[model samples]
Target: MSWNKLLCNLRELQLSGTLNGGQSFRWEYNKEMDEWTGVFSKTVWKLRQREEFLQYKVIGSLLQSIVQKKNDVEFDNNGVFEGLLKKYFRLDFNLSDYYTKWSEKDDLFKAACKQFYGIRMLAQEPVENLFSFICSQNNHISRISSMVEKLCKHYGEEICEQDGVTYYSFPDVEKLSTPKVESELRQLGFGYRAKFIQKSAAQILEWEGEKWFAGLQDMKYKEARLELMKLCGIGPKVADCICLMSLNHLEALPVDTHVYQIAAQNYLPHLRGKKNVTEKMYSEIGDHFRSLYGDYAGWAHTVLFCADLKKFQQTTDSEDIKPKKRRKKT
Candidate 1:
């Protein structure tokens, strides 16, 4: 159960994306085991336990694998955190300008960031982020997390144990592609999303190795997102979530209902009367934010969303704390 040494600033990983309390696709630390575990579908993947640089054991190799498999939904040892942080967060970028712009217009956004005590952002596995967001469509956070957890526990490989807790490895495409296995996910409360997961898994599994990797390579970020959308259950927003969280494409704008509301209220007041926001509209919005904020648009969005949620919770708390006036005698 003893890890070599913990990273002092480890919470930075959680800031890579917006994850509400008890949400399906967020990582949480296990205090007893001194490990960071991501729980999706009731299966836990030990993402990072100790400082890998300090402990040059299999843990370092494992961390690299999980981060490298960035855009692929299955959790593996594909990520290299030290390089990722240096390239992404610690380097020079206009964090102040974006924060100011977001704070100037949106009180909610400002409040949420302040409330969370400046958790940086969450960097999610590309494939899992993609599939998670797809499952999120017309769904609640609790249900989505539950479904993903089930998928991992049922199909993924058991990787390691820390303390008394065992972690499971995320399934690869081959394991998830089978219809017989995917159907069982419905029994775990995936409901209609079971078919989408199965079909997408099959579609990816059918691709030739180089062909699949090649498809992910393209200069235009939009192109990469579009390629993902061709699969079942992957819409524009879901694709963008994959791009931003997994592929490290920082400008990708994922407009869920929360984001849409935030945008409409803060930046685009005139976007009223549109039955459904179009891809073109999303593009324009994304481009404007990118131009205004530069490389960290996705991060900015995540921070703002988290800030908004915090504000909402604060308001609720304040109302609850207010005393009711005594009723006058009739």
Candidate 2:
């Protein structure tokens, strides 16, 4: 298959950080090929980065015909795919501009930018983002990813098979809302999250059907977050996550334990030594970031969050120390 190109800079968007950085859990990296394969918008995609552009290939069948009709666009297949990719990665928003503004206001963000550039927030589909985060409570990324994969394998429709591995689209609300889904998910090792997934799906269907999430984009941030919290197992944090990631509420920040630590150490020292983040503390942390970074506080929080991750820390440490050791030897 021919690789299609999207003009993108490495400094503006890094696939390594954005794809696997706990936002969405579907992407799998192939070390040898240096590419990522994932499913979204009912299509499987393989993507890699070149110096000045992103190279991508459609792996299997696509459901973009509906998208084309909705947008009333007569573009070719590649054009439609390109539009989807742009929307998914949110390429319209200039990350460099945000980085400049963030760095100017906060010294920590300025420091984080040294080693953590190109961490863009993904504009994920609301249905996928909702359930994926429902699985994230008190869990790590690796396990959350496994559970999400199982959901697709069991409930989602098969898109295609590549290299002896099958890929499935994330199941729609109707599919997940069936009476038996909860029990089946528990058997699949979803544990307590199984109920959340099934109940949330059923709630979506009952409240406003599949198109309900689209309505959230038109609401204010606080209003949208409250609407999400009305679902089972969705708390303030998960609600904020869905709001920022899928609902286009850029100011919404999800204050989890990791985020709380970051806030305590740098932004809110008064929160230091606090064992748990209370509801009030959560508001404080998020509000501080919003005050600091303004509209795109969640996006800024992601950059700092990525910088604090052990994976990125190890990479930064290696790069920083290797050259210094070489210099000393020389």
Clashes of each: 34, 0
- Candidate 2 TM-score, true structure as reference: 0.91
How would you encode candidate 2's per-residue C-alpha lDDT over 70-119 as one tens digit per residue?
87976477887899899999999998988999999999999988888899
Predictions in order: lDDT: 0.55, 0.83
With candidate 2 superimposed using the best TM-score fit, by how many Å does residue 78's alpha carbon deviate from the native?
1.0
Q: lDDT tens string, model 1, 3-94?
A: 33224332333332323322234455444544444543223334432322322123222443454477566543223333343343332343
TM-score of each: 0.68, 0.91
Candidate 1, residue 85: Cα displacement in angstroms equals 8.5
> Could you tell me how far off, in angstroms, the CA of residue 169 lies in candidate 2 after the best superposition?
0.3
| Candidate 1 RMSD computed on C-alpha atoms after optimal superposition onto the true structure | 9.4
Off by over 4 Å in 1: 3-26, 29-36, 39-119, 161-165, 209-214, 273-275, 312-330
Indicate the residue-level lDDT of 165 in model 1: 54
Q: What is the C-alpha RMSD of each candidate to the true structure, in Å?
A: 9.4, 6.8
